[model samples]
Target: MKATVYVTIKQNVLDPQGSAVQGALHSMGFDEVGKVRIGKYLELELNTTDRAEAESRLKAMCEKLLANTVVEDYRFELEG
Candidate 1:
């Protein structure tokens, strides 16, 4: 199975990196941007025939390492 995880800061968290990128983009002539957020993506491939087990394990992984539940949000999808 293949899993894709996306980790992003929550709406209430301050994202200085994203702000910097937006500023640079504006300086480069893209002035329509208002807000931006930086995130991390993780892709994993595993040998698992049981989807339920995979999902549970994936969630645990995200909770442990893939995302910081205190200030970030994360979601993942699994595929073959």
Candidate 2:
């Protein structure tokens, strides 16, 4: 199985890098884009068939170490 996790800052959070990227894009003539935010994407491979258990473990993994829940939100997709 494979899991792809995305972790990003909640709205109202500061994202300097994203802002920089947006500025660069504007300078490069991509003016339609605004309020860009950055995030982390993690891909994991697991050897398991139990979907529920794997999701539980994956949630725990995010809560414990993969993300900082205090200011970040995360979502994951799993596929076999």
Candidate 3:
């Protein structure tokens, strides 16, 4: 199975990197760009075929390492 994970900053947190990118874009004539937030995408391959176990493991992975629960949120999709 393949797992695709997306990790993003919490809405209440400040995203400096995202802000910088937005600023650069505006300077380059893309002035319509508004609030920007940065995030992380991750892909993982697992040997298991069971959806239940995969979901449990994936949640543990996100909570323990893939995302900082205090400032980030994560969600994932699984495919065979």
In terms of lDDT, which candidate is strongest?
3
Q: How accurate is candidate 3 locally (lDDT)?
A: 0.97
Question: In model 2, which residue pairs have backbone atoms overlapping below 3 Å?
Answer: none
Question: Can you list the residue pairs that collide in candidate 1?
Answer: none
lDDT (CA) for every model shown?
0.95, 0.95, 0.97
Which tens-of-lDDT digit does each residue in 1-80 have in candidate 3? 99999999999999999999999999999999999999999999999999999999999999999999999999999998
Candidate 1 lDDT, 1-80, residue by residue in tens: 99999999999999999999999999999999999999999999979989999999999999998899999999999998
Off by over 4 Å in 2: none
Residue-pair clashes per prediction, in order, are 0, 0, 0
Best by TM-score: 3
Worst 10 residues of 1 by lDDT: 40-49
Q: Which of candidates 2 and 3 reaches a greater TM-score?
A: 3
TM-scores, each model vs. reference: 0.96, 0.93, 0.97
Candidate order by lDDT, decreasing, is 3, 2, 1
lDDT of 2 by residue, 10-63 (tens): 887898999999999999999999799999999999899999999999999999
RMSD of 1: 0.7
Better of 1 and 3 by lDDT: 3
